[model samples]
Target chain A: MDFSSVFLNAALAAVSPANLLFCFLGTIVGIVIGALPGFTSTMGVALFIPFTYSMHPATGLIFLVSIYCSSTYGGSISAILINTPGTPSAVITTIDGYEMTKNGEGGRALAMAVFSSLVGGIVSALALLLIAPPLARLVLLFGPVEIFYLALFGLSVIVGFSKGSLIKGLISGVAGLLLATVGVDGISGVYRYTFDNVSLFEGIPIVPMVIGLFSTCQVFVLGEQKRTTIVHDIATFSDSSVPRMSDIKAHWFNMLRSSVIGTIVGIIPAAGMSIACAIAYNEAKRVSKHPEKFGNGSVEGVIASEAANNGVTGGSLVPLLTLGVPGNTVSAIFLGGLLIHGLRPGLQLFTKYADVSYTLLVGLFIANVMMFVVGLFAAKQVVKVTKASTDLLAPIIMLLCVVGSYAIRNNLFDVGVMLVFGIVGYLMKRWGYSTPSMILGLILGPMAEGEFRRALMLSRGNWSYFCSRPVSIILLVLIVITLVGPALRNRRIMSK
Target chain B: MTKYLDEYLPIAFLYALSAYFWWDVEDFTADSLMYPRALVGVLLVLTTLLLVFTLMKKMRLPQSKDENSPFKFCVVLAASIVYVFAVPFLGFAVSSLLYAPATALLLGYKRKGMVFFVSILTVVLIYIGFRTVLKVPLPTVTLLGMTL
Candidate 1:
């Protein structure tokens, strides 16, 4: 456990005036952005990244991590208050959260989100301490082919996320794959799609693409909606709105189950908060005595979603710090942040950067603790953000999107990409298609295609290679379940 | 003013766009085929499937009732293309400064004061952040013959 080092360094980093203050500011800003329906912790990390380019690596890493942790919880505020998720991870929160808000129990919902987020964070941090080292040993077995397949597996989440239409998800995934092909082919050195532009040599930048998909598209949707104002009225809350001990006692099992679900999902590369929240919410509802209460402001529902989503932050880091494989988009950025600071994530990261690493783990733990305090104190104000009209915020957010997109590479072509995706997203949203699926496809499709093709070549065009390896077989089985399990359940419910 | 054109036209355009890309893939062989071919293939396949699905189900997709589709969609797409082409000539800062306000106006913002203030301020903020703070390169389009 490196108890001595973890304790000494964590203590040092946790209490430092500058470090502590940065953590506080990051959380506050993170919660604000997360409370806004269109902004996400992913966007928060992306937008704030340029700012981090100036700070020391450790300080910068701390700031970004703090934002990532807090923003996951912050999303529930909007979900509870306005029935719109500020982040995809909080989508499940809206099912029950908004119901509670309508019944004038928004404060309690918010409190539960905070408490659960904290519990999830703390539990996962301890797990991080116990589990990360062994995982690092396992990661050493990964070669380029294995890494490629892993990336592919991560991207396949699009299949599950693609609304009712796997075709649309496939389209989005293929589109992302094609874009990933831009620039000189990494292996062949052949220029596949650069069209004579020098900038295309490096391939389309991930920062630009991500910003385009999440932020710019967000702007377009907001602008089109042209909402002017949002209603912010909720019956005043007394101190009792803070989750009571009995309330916590009542949901302890739900909390544990949800946190475990969140951690497991979070550990998988590319399966981010949205997946965790969805899984946790479903499980919570499944075992609930009042299952029907799930979508109607059930406190268990709020706990399940929030805890599971934020739990991803800790679970995600396990793979990242141990394996250098990012667990989700935000973790990918965190990897970049680590690299920009002259740190490489692999096994040596533990031995060489142990103090810094432990400090981050501890900081993550503290960030969750702080999330509870800040969230509880600011729950009222946070709800007001949700109440703000999407129409008004959309344009400004669009502006911010433009700024963020352009800021990444100072390229307008990237901005154009954002607008393109935005329109596509709007259309998909209107059609009841799953944007998450498309995003998953877009994010993971190329990785899967590239790796699957490469793995084939390495094995002399053998398809059974994936099945032969125990881990690969297990993962493939899990992937199949992830894809088919939901449909089976949905069908069962419908038939009933 | 009351026409079905607004309803069916966009879908038809998408259908056409998908078809065009689908056909365009034949221009290159596998080695020559870039990622766009796969993307276009997926897009065409999905759009066609969606089209069929919607038709079979008698589903009518949602469209804005404001009769603003053709113009807004066209303008938005055009603005994006123009921004890309203008970048090397106008440089990022000046182009963005000009583009933000202009695009806002096109999106239906009417107040001159708001437009001008937003345009100028947005440009300045971006300039300070991208140029000054982050030190990201903001090239000026010197070839455009516009000095400022």
Candidate 2:
């Protein structure tokens, strides 16, 4: 409850050289993993968690936080240079960034990403410092009913992300919900779908499932295509003119607005950088005078998406540190790291472990600085990797995917799951289903179920409790609109 | 591959699957029965509806259809099944190395040497990284002293 000691401790811990070194290591590794296509910041953090188990809790947390921040920026490097995104978060970045590269402005785009990421990250860090405590205090008012509704609100996002036919997305989502039901039924202490496997008792491991779905699946799909290497001939920083001060001045407002939008979206549980970037891009386009220029190398689009995605790094940390709830996969692994060190998150973290929290915040700031420098210096080399032939890249990515999945608890079953999902994912792709919605469902299904069950239990089976609360009602309405509004609009247009 | 999944053959297959699972899980109680059974039931119903829709469209206007490559699909499906079965027994390194080259050749890889080299490297790197860095204690059946 005392604030003075916590702040003092945090400030001291943050300034420590050892913590700084760990932060540096995390940032470097995060950047490398994020720069490589088929690997994500989430996967990087998960793979890196085992290595941090032996360290002090503060050091371990700092390392993880640094990785979380840096890897987000790293994703844009690939998206900008190559048409392929290093992570899902960078998907929006590819639209304008790749176009910029095609227009022979690769170096400037890379520079813009680095600078905007730093600005966005720093802004979010400041917001985290200013807003987290007060917001956390407000969150403390939440009962099981509120938490349940919040979880539902998070899970309902799957409908929003569904592409093509909503039916297929619904099927995929239900499949994920079914998968989440496997292992022990938490409330009843009964096994639901374990089928007698000992490993199923603990449930499908999050790390492996995530790695399998995203990485392993990617490998199998890529392997199916004949390997064709692409060699890019983009100009380097020296060859390509550095972005002018006028350019930075012109885009400063766009960067700020996108960062704010991105951070807010990131704070919403389960809304990852992909959505943040997309939302930011849409908002920027909506407000821009020359919206038509967006997909054709618009600097506004690049600024909006790049800043927004990076801003997610700090915004995501708010829930994790405050509620012991992860907003996304990377934060989930970081939460695991904290638990391994015998540190209980939530209110205690802010008060008792304030020093550690401050240290993490400082580490994030340091990581962003490092990301900017590294991205600027190594933009040329990063671009060259994009040009590498698909044949060579595909096999290498396949190897990384296997290793990444295996690294998560060393389970061969997870590897198999990954391959199986990969094939399924490929088929789904060919069949016109959205992989993003499926992933969202897989991530949020269990949370939604647990909350729904708990809310029902607390309310003694009162179904109206969800609508009684203003926030929950609003979220429910939004979910409905997101799901049905699109369909109605499309139908109206078709009828005309 | 070009044919929509909403068709007669796939619909019939789903019906068969639903029936088989329904039988396979006859002994389980209501709690156990609810989730997967509901899922399978939905699959059957949806596929059946899709099939009906396709049939209705066909009735409206019959047209010539291209010959579907069911054989190629069966081959790929069979290969996947074999790959999963082979992985554990042959070891990840061995099975994956073979799997990549075999798949490449099947997908029509002309550069044999490049494919072979890439496959070998893929297996070696995965083995080293997983074993050394992540410390995955994968089984190595070195009866012939082929150390990985």
Candidate 3:
């Protein structure tokens, strides 16, 4: 809550001309990531990390923050113009946005998207700066048992809600957790699954694995599409500026409520932007006087969808920066960035690295403004990325995947790992398995194992100790809700 | 060509991999192997269930007939494998220069001249970005009298 020092330091760091330039560049790249179909924010961040290898930590992180924010906004451009969501968060945006586009309100739709995203971004960033410290303090009270259950909750949430069979998704997640154990066992110094390969001793490399899953697999998917055209036209409305103030004032309640929903969902590990947008859109439709107007060019739907998507940008960072755990796939990549810079995400971030942390917070606000400005001016130009040939895009992305895999640790073996995973990823996609759940399983497996072991050791192998603690009990209940709630909902739908 | 085996294809791969994974971790001590063993065991069982679910569904409903070619996918994938393996000996510059065009052609890009030009430019930019700017050593290989 102490603001004087953070304000001065953050001002100095974020306002610097070089940092501003990098932040601007990151926003542009993020917009591209968001505008391009199948180019996820996670993949973009992973691809860019190797480029930041030799830069200042503050500069690198601020740049990444810009990318994270603008990309969320960028997804709307494609969603509105092309009926294809550039990111999963924008999937809801497509319903109203494309409807509006078809109805010739495309300009107003894009404009509303930009305005709502700005409001959501600022609100979430403010929440991140003010609320994270207290949350971090609460997190400090958590025992190993609490953290272990939290990890379990994080791992199961995505699997439980996957598009196809929940059991099948859980299987994919289990496979990832198994892959996470492929290195030397930390407790006993025993080689677990290495099979005498020296590269396996350090564990399966996450960077290459993610690139394989998100980037290379996307390349394969693009090729499968054989798309000769992304969209025939953007509609004449896109050539103009944003929506009017009356339009903004009309939907103010939806924007504010969805921002709140987005922030809350973002703070919960693995609850993701898709959930945020869905809940927000559902809430908006329920509360609207013209509820039937939804799915047919409803401006309220656009506001709810875009605001929540952008709010997720700020909300996700809360759990990540304070708890040293990722809230989503993008934050998991951000965690990799933080670790790469030797800046751990918990208490040390707010105390020892407060200067860098505040700088990132302020930089995110600046990034939002930049996104709105860029979106207003360049919507016509940037939206055309969809028209880029799949043949060209796929090869270039695959090239980056190869180089990204090789660049990490300078290991060619990692390139092989990435290729194998790419094939596996493509097959998984074809099979409708949940990739993010697997990634979460891989990211959280070691943490879950280590914390569970520590909790048991502290209790002298008393299995009842975890259930006795309030935090652990609450977290266990949440995990139960995460798993059982979905199954029950599915059953209800089936019975109907 | 007559009938697609796409439904069983994924399950077949999963069964094979999980079987290998099950056999792979058999040698570790119980404490060390506990988590991985559980995961792989669950994967094995769940994959079996997935197979059963697919069969049951097919029995009740018509299976989707996939006419999409795996030709482009397999060719690009094989090219990537070659490019990755070749990079160690050929250097990133040479291998990627060769790889880019090959993949583009395999993907049915009709313009050969543009592909050739883009491939060269791509290699140069990558070399500068990774090798020169980032100072990462991208496996310099010696051919004839020159180190590249």
TM-score of each: 0.74, 0.74, 0.90
For model 2, residues A155-213, the per-residue Cα lDDT tens digits are 44444444555555555555565566667766666665567887777666555555455
From the highest TM-score down, the ranking of the candidates is 3, 1, 2
Every model's DockQ: 0.24, 0.18, 0.46
Give me the candidate number with maximum lDDT.
3
Error of 1 at B128 (Å): 5.5
Q: What is the TM-score of chain B in candidate 1?
A: 0.53
Candidate 1 local lDDT, residue A306? 86
DockQ of 1: 0.24
Q: Which residue runs does candidate 3 get wrong by more than 4 Å? A: A1-3, A102-105, A242-246, A249-254, A282-300, B1-30, B48-67, B142-148
1 or 3: which has the higher TM-score? Answer: 3
Which rank order by lDDT, best down to worst?
A: 3, 1, 2
Candidate 2, residues B46-127: lDDT per residue as tens digits? 5566556567663111222222234433434455557656766776677677767775566445688988888887677656
Model 2 stretches with alpha carbons more than 4 Å out: A1-106, A137-139, A230-237, A240-254, A268-305, A316-361, A434-482, A485-496, B6-136, B141-147
lDDT of 1 by residue, A371-465 (tens): 88898898678667665444334444555555555655677666666666666655655554444444444344445556655676678756677
If both were scored by DockQ, which would come out higher, candidate 1 or candidate 3? 3
Tell me the chain A TM-score of model 1.
0.78
- Tens digits of per-residue lDDT for model 3, A278-347: 9999999999999998999998999999999888888999988887656777887787677668787677
